[model samples]
Target: MNPNVTVINPTITEDKESKIRVAAYCRVSTNSEDQQNSLITQMRYYENFLSDSETERLVSVYADEGITGTQMDKREEFQRMLKDCRRGKIDRIIVKSISRFARNTKDCLSVLRELKELGISVMFEKENIDTANITDEIMVTVMGGLAQEESASISNNVRWGIRSKMKNGTVKFHSAPLGYDLYEGNLIINKREAEIVKSIYKMFLSGMGYDSICRELNESKVIKNDKGTKWLSASVRYILTNEKYIGDSLWQKNYNTSMPYRKVRNKGELEKYYINNTHEAIITREEFEKVQELIEQRKHPNMNLINNYPLSKKIYCGKCGSLFKRRFKNEKSYWICREHYYNAENCRTKPILEQVFYTAFMTMYNKLKANYSVIFTPMLTQLQELKNKKYGSNKQYIEINKEIAQLKEQTHVLARLKTKGFLDVSKYIEQVTEINAKIEKLNRELRKIVRCDDEDEMIEQIKEIASIIENGTDLMTEFDDVMFESLIEKIIVKNQTEFEFNLIGGLKFTENSIDNCT
Candidate 1:
C-alpha cells in the first residue's frame, strides 16, 4: 500500500447478504368470470415464482377485484400495500403492468418518487421497468401517461354505449329497485314486493313519520333491503319518494364526470331522460305527489325556533361521550345526553339539570380566577424553554450546516486551483477571504435563528382567555355563556354523581352532584 494513502478495514462498508422481501400487487377492472380467472392466475403465478426463487422472500400478495385502477381510494388492497411499504414492511413490489399498479399518471409518479426516497422499488413485469433505475423514470412516465389515457378512453366508450341505448329507449340499469323486477329488459311489478311498497306509502300518507314506519316494519320482521336488514329511516323515505312506484322511469339521474371519474348526482349536470308508464304502478301518482308535499312541510316544522344557546354543542356526556342536547319538558329547559335520550341503554347517566351544572361550573371558574397566576406562571416558563429548544433544532439550522460544509469544500478547491497554476495566488487569497467572511456571517445568523422567545404567542393566548371571562373573584350567580365557551373544552361525566371538566389549556378539575356543591 502507498504511504500517502490511509487504509481501513473493508467490513464496515460491505453489503449484507440478506434475502430481498418481495410482494406482488394484482387487480382486475371488471368482476366478469374471465377477468376474475385471469386475476387469480396472475396471483398464483406470482406466489409460485416468489416461493420458488432462491434470492427473494415472499412478503405478501395484495389483490383488488372489480375496482378501477384510476382511483386509489377505492382499492382497499392497493392502499394496504402502500401503507405496508410506508411502514418498511415491504422492500420491493411487483405488479403485472403499470395499469394494474395505477392508471392515473400523477398518482403513479408521486407514489414512485416516495418509494424511491424510501429505498423501495416497484417492478412492472409487462413493461420490464424497475423504478430503482434512474434512467427508467422517463420511460415509466411515458407508459403511465398512455395507461391513464387508455383508462379514460375505456370509460368514455362505456358511457357512449350506454347513452346510445338510452336514446333508443332500451337502456337497462341492473339495480332492481324495491317493488320492480327486470323481465326481458322491462320493469315489471313484483306483487309481493309491490304490496309492501303500497303499505309504506299508505302509512306515510296516514300521518306516520319515517322512524315510526321503520319501527312498524322492523316489528313485523319485513325483510326490507336485498341484504335482509331492518328498514332504516332513510330507506323508508327512499321507498316513499321513488318515481318508479308511480309507473315512470328516470334514466341517467346520476353520471360519472371526467377522468379518475367520480359518480355524482345529476342536478342538471347532464341530460336526464324520463320515460312514462315504463312499469306497472305500485301507488297512484296523486298519492306520490301528496307524500312529496308532506315531506317538504315536515322538513321545516320548527323553522321559527332558532337556537341562541352558546353551549349547545359544547357540553358533552361524561358516561357515553355524547353531546348534551337542549330539551324542554314541562316548561323547563334542561341539557340531556343525546344518546341517553335516544336510547337509555347506551348511556345510563342521569341528566344534569341545567341549573345544577351551571352552579358547579361557576364555582370552579371562581377558583380558577383566584389561582390563575399560581397555575399559569410555571406552565408559561416550561413552555418557553420548550419553544426555544424547538427553534434551535429547526430546519433552518440543518440547512445552514449543509451550506457551511459546501463553502468549506469550495475553499479547498480554491487552494488546489492556486497550486495547479489555474488561479493567481492573490486572486485565490481574495476568494478564500470573501468565502470565509460569508461563512462567518452565515454562522452568526444560524446561531440567532435558534433560541427565539415565544413569549408573545404565550402572552396572546393568556390575554384572549382573560378577555373572554370576568377578572373578579366574585362567584357567578347564573350561567355565563361567554365564560363557559372561553374556558371549558368538554365535560366528561363519570356517572350520575360526578363529572370531570377539562379546560381549554389542558387543565382538568372534577365536580360532584348539586347536593355536594356549596
Candidate 2:
C-alpha cells in the first residue's frame, strides 16, 4: 500500500472555475487637487492590481470625493460597493486603508462583520489584513480605533484653527448671505438683493408678519438664494434676525460637537465673537433691534396663530372677552367667538362675516387718510418734540444699559463655572434662569426707553401709511389685505352689526357691517 501511494489530483469542474469578482473603494475627505489626484491613483492602482490577477475580475472602482469617512452614511460610493457585495456581484473589496474606508470604529466593524457573513472578504492593503484570513477581529478593532482617534484629532485641529480665526476677526465668510456677495473674503452688498433685504426689514417693521412677508415675496415671484425657491416664514425670520444685514458679523452662533457630531445653537455653550462695521449696512442697528423686540412680543405658544389668516387672534368678543376663531359654513368664512363656537350657551355673541372686518378696515383706513393732516400730523409733531426732549443724557437709560451689561457678564461667569464643574447642573440652570429673568426685565425697561428714542421710526411709519393711502385707488374699490395688516391692530365685535377697529397707534373707530355680506 505504501508503494502504491500515488497522489490523485481532484477534478476541477467548469462550474467551480468562476473568477472572483473584486471591487475597490476609494475616498478623499476633501476636494483639493492633491486629494483628487490621490483618489485617481488609488482607483488606477486597484484596477491594475485586479487586472494582473487571472483569478480576480475587476467589477468596479467606487470612489467618493469630498466626503467625510467618519459617517458611513455620507459615503455614496462606499455604500454602493457594499450593495454590490450583497448582490453577489462582488466577492472581495479592496481598500487603501481602514481610514480610507471608514474612520468610525463601530461602522467599520459592523460592515466587516456583514461582509464576512456574506462570504465576502475585505483587504486593507496598507494594513496587510484580509477579513477572510483573520482568525479574530482584535487587530481590526485596534486599527479601527486608531483610525477613529486620528479622525478625532483632525477634527479638533480644524475646530481650533477656525476658532482661532474667529477670535482674531479674520475668519472668512464661506458663503454670502441673501443680500451680499463674498469677494476676497469680504462681504460686498449685492445691490439688487440688498433692496430685497431692506424691504423685508421694512415690511416687518410695518407690522407685516413673517407669513405675510413670505406670501408677498412668493406671490410676486421674488427669487431667493439665487434659486427660485418658494419663500418660507423661516427665511424671512432669518433675514430679520441676522446681524449681517446691520453691517456686523456675529461668529459662532452655531457650533458642532465632537465626534458623532451634531450641529447646535451656541446658546452660551461656546464663546461668540461680534465684530461691527464688517460690511455695508443693509438695515440700521436700531431697525434690527426694533424688529427683535417685535419678534419677541409676537411669539405665541400656538404656532398656528403666528401664520393664521389676517383676522386670526385679532378679533375678540366684546361681551365675553374671548378670542374669535375662524369657521366655515356654506362655503363661506366667519369669525365666531371661541366660546360661542364650542358651546353656544356659554356666549351669546354672533359669528361675524369675515368680509365685514375687511370692509371695516378699508373704511377706517380711508378715513385716516382723509384726516391725516388733522389727526396723524399733529400727533407726529408731538412725538418728534418728545423724542427731541429725551435725546440727551438719559440717566435711567444709562443705568439700565449698565445693569444689562453686568447681568450678561454674570451669565458668562456662570457658564464658565458650569464648565469647570464648580456648579451643579440644576443649580446652574436655576441661577441662569434667575439671571435671565432679571436681564429680561431690564431689557424690557430699556426697550421702553428705546421706543421713546424711536419717535423717528413712528414718524416715518405714519408717513408710510399716509403715502399708501394717498397713492391708493379712489375710494378703495377692493379690500386690500396688506393695508389691513399694516394699519389695524385688532377688531372687536361690539354687537351683531357694529364692529370696532383698533388701529396700530392706539386709535379706534367704529363701523357698521353691511347686512348679509357673507
lDDT of 2 by residue, 1-518 (tens): 46767898868865435888888888887766698768767766776687678788878778888867678888766876788788888898888889888887888899999999999999998889898899798999999998888888988887899899988888878779898988977899899999999999999888788667877997987877422335655567678889999899999987877778765567687999998887889898899999887776654322323335667668889899999988878877788899998999999987877777777777777777677668766877787778656755788877887898788667756654554457887998799999999998887776666654346445655554555455444577566554565566678888888889875445578987676354
Model 1 lDDT per residue over 1-518, tens place: 65787788666542333678898898888776698767767767787787767778878777788767778988877887888889998889999888888887889899999898888999998888888775566787899998888788878887888888877778765667888888766778788888899999999788776656767998998966433344555567668878888888788877887875755567676788887777688899999999888776554423213343544556777666798887766655677888988999888866666666767788777776677667666666777677667666778877887898789768756744554458897898799999999999887776455424344344445444543332433566665643564566577777665768876445588987654321
Best by lDDT: 2
Candidate 1 residues lying further than 4 Å off, grouped into runs, are 1-19, 44-54, 57-60, 83-89, 135-143, 165-196, 204-237, 246-248, 274-281, 284-518
C-alpha local distance difference test of each model? 0.73, 0.77
**Model 1: how far residue 117 lies from native, Å:** 4.0
TM-score of each: 0.45, 0.53
Q: Which residue pairs clash in candidate 1?
A: 318-492, 318-493
lDDT score of model 1? Answer: 0.73
TM-score, candidate 2, is 0.53
